[model samples]
Target: MSSTPANPPTALHEVWLIRHGETQWSLSGQHTGSTDIALTDHGRAQARALAPRLATQSFDAVWSSPMARAIETCELAGLGGQRVIVQDLHEWDYGIYEGRTTPEIRASVPGWSVWDSPVPKGESLLQIQARAEAVVARLLAASGRVAIFSHAHFLRALAGCWMGGAAALGAHLYLDTASISLLGFDHESRAIRRWNS
Candidate 1:
């Protein structure tokens, strides 16, 4: 029996990745991982700004990292009632690098980068990738539009994984605070619809 070349690619759900707004550590360029910090005043304003943009679309589900920053952003973005906390969405565990800036880390090890360098006593890139992949799997299984509010590094990792790339690919995805990104299928292939908006 002959069959059509592979069936047409199934349309995938759309995912909106939202990076939490500005925080003291975010502004200061600190690692800010696993620190559970809150958003700054301007950060709150930034989150409020998201409400209008997000209101344009209706999401089937809204997810947030357990961190205060992500939770607050989700709430301020007018999704608090629908926000579901996902631990896997939390920021990378910086460990020894926690609260340290890239410049500070590079002072000792020149050109050190989180994507390539080892995170001593902390989650490795592989570990972060696993979490990201897990979350991606869940999103793929779900229907309709989904929104996630999380930290920068983790969200970048998730984006990379969503595109079937390694976590290190996040090195090239420059995410700004309070930015929104969209991920969905491009015809038959997984693609980034819009990014860093």
Candidate 2:
């Protein structure tokens, strides 16, 4: 039998990660998780602005968090028909911290930080990291470019995982509402192509 040559490596695909538009709680700096809040009027406008930019790209698949804000943002961005709701893309579960601002949490628990402190009765950092990893794995297994619409904290965690870092690293990445980010491999090494765009 003749020897066969190894197959060439597949080219890396990009994943477009978009943070959902602003909500009443997000505008107020509240920790919104599992609250099912809707986007504000300004948020709708912001999402609409993304339509032109997103229209230029051809995504093989589009995923979104089950939250209304994320779904609404996807719709306003003109990608509604392509969206497939993914539970793993949902925001962090805030539990007792839901709807509470950082200042308020600090007032009750001095020097408390979501990244540094434990969230009482909420999802742990490990859990968030696991979810992010799963989403990344699924996207990598798929063909062509992918788009994901989700929340700030969760998307930050996903970005961290994409860069082969722990979820805590997400604290260093700040994501604003209605923001668009890109994650792709650079010559076989994972990289953040763009952030907070």
Q: Which stretches of candidate 2 lie over 4 Å from their true place?
A: 1-11
Task: Give the distance in Å from residue 80's predicted Cα in candidate 1 to where it truly belongs.
Answer: 0.6
Q: Each model's number of backbone clashes?
A: 0, 0
For model 2, what is the C-alpha lDDT against the true structure? 0.87
- TM value for model 2: 0.93
Least accurate 10 contiguous residues by lDDT in model 2? 1-10
* Candidate 2 RMSD computed on C-alpha atoms after optimal superposition onto the true structure: 4.9
RMSD of each: 3.8, 4.9
lDDT of 2 at 127: 90
Cα error, residue 164 of model 2, in Å, equals 2.1
Q: Which stretches of model 1 miss by more than 4 angstroms? A: 1-11
lDDT of 1: 0.88
Residues 13-118 of candidate 1: C-alpha lDDT, one tens digit per residue: 6889999999999999999998989899999999999999999998889999999999999999999999999999999999899999999999998988899889
Compare the candidates by lDDT and give the number of the best one: 1
**Per-candidate local distance difference test:** 0.88, 0.87
lDDT of 2 by residue, 134-157 (tens): 887776667678899999999999
